[model samples]
Target: MQDPNTLCRRAVEYLEEYRDSQRHLRADGVGRSVGDVWKPPPNSIFKLNFDATVFVEAKRTRFGAIIRNDKGAVMAAMSTGGPPMSSSEEAELLAGRKAVEFATDVGFSELVIEGDNRNVMKALSSSLDDRSLLGNVVDDVRHLVYGMHWINFSCIRRGGNRVAHALVQHARNISEDVFWLEDSPPPALNALYQDSLLL
Candidate 1:
């Protein structure tokens, strides 16, 4: 009793699933073929750090991030944004998405995202609550998740994310323009950030 159109759509979805399964199987077979040789693990695991800052009541909202690797070196793509939110939560999600884009564009195999926002991390680590706005963000997050071999989110105390935190605070003073730091922010910002006791 289903509509003919619905049936055709379902059929196409089944075919797509079958194709994906075959592709995965072929990839696994190739890995098995190379099992006898020792291989080093992938090096594309990069660390993504995020933070957000609000200046004035709603005047300035900024989000920032840094992507680093095991060597503690930063990636070329760093960004700070005057994101679309009137609140910190909005900046947090915007920063998170920027991190996701950096990972995808740079072809990282694994991503470890750290943020100073505990609420944002808790929301992402848990199942999406259908009634909450976070559900919408969680839905978009899955798209980035699918591209990674491994993706993990951790909530760190603000003190642990000074580099990213400083970026946001620094951006809060600037105009609508978004800035990418070349040599990192000045020592005063770092000193002020450490003294802020953001932890």
Candidate 2:
């Protein structure tokens, strides 16, 4: 017969392996579910998806935002290039700031702001005081949020924010910031078309 200690050890090992497999299965499921697609906000609300791209060589960061209504029709779009940033997270924070300023300028009171950077989104969405490197940016974004009649900040999978990503890429080729009413840059048109289909 096997010794009791040996049997207990074997049981523990088997249980650990089982638990690990279960964890992996759950992770895999989540991974498979992240097929990013743009989603509209509720009626009377505008959804704004934003993204930022940092150009190390140019020493600048580009931001892009797209605002759409519940019907998924594009309301407006913006692409801006700004000063250099140290990290992508910081760039993302700037994008959030830009989105808020753009919406506010456009007289939009109700909006949902989304981005692909989870860390930046979490900082902006939560009330927790930012004590890290992005503290100042977080503070500014909070100030913007408070000015809005109603605003929701959220993080989305990169796949879901492709159009914003594409817009920033387009911004890199332009000299100045630009906004669109019902049109988009030619390079970003394909991504805009794809997002429309998802809606």
Candidate 3:
């Protein structure tokens, strides 16, 4: 058995090595092609970017989604909360599902769904069924996608999804699902404005 001091040293070394690898990856420009700018969907289609944040101590997860038209106008925004999830992937899956539901509720026939979770995006974009514990959630999202006239699934870097990311963090402060048609939380509005300027 290893002594406590040895274990502590090993943990510190592992963390240092992990940080170094990340720095090297960034410096080498490897495994990172996507830019941080938010891109709009094609003409006539709305883009839905969704994200989630977990609060383990509170045993709750918060989800947020923002819908914008091709012209970079905010169509709608939603923030909701649910039971705590065991993994960020699960939280992301739930956020994607919420985005779909919100789109359907708003009668959007065509759309593009975007998220920062690569695994969740891949599962939803693929034709093959997801057989993991989160399969049910993925299946439901797939069903929603099929119902739409046209739907595209895309993965984005967290930096590019600032508005939705901010909304998710804002969800923790609200009690119920809130929707904004013409207005949004200040942080999200600021993010939207910043992203719009890039268009």
Please report, in order, the local distance difference test score of every candidate based on alpha carbons. 0.62, 0.84, 0.85
Candidate 1's residue-wise lDDT over 53-166, tens digit each?
Answer: 766575666766766665554553353555456667767876776667666766676878777678778766666563576667666666777767897777776655767776
RMSD (CA, Å), candidate 3 to true, equals: 15.6
Q: Could you tell me every candidate's TM-score relative to the true structure?
A: 0.62, 0.79, 0.80
Task: Give lDDT tens digits, candidate 2, residues 75-188.
Answer: 889889988887898899889899888888888889999999988888899888889977988898888778788888878998888888988998998899989876665666
Error of 1 at 124 (Å): 1.5
Order of quality (TM-score): 3, 2, 1
- What stretches of model 2 exceed 4 Å from their correct place? 1-35
* Model 1, C-alpha of 194: deviation from truth (Å): 9.5
**Sort by lDDT, top down from the best:** 3, 2, 1
* Colliding pairs, model 3: none
By TM-score, how accurate is candidate 3?
0.80
Give the count of colliding residue pairs in each prediction.
Answer: 0, 1, 0
TM-score of 1: 0.62
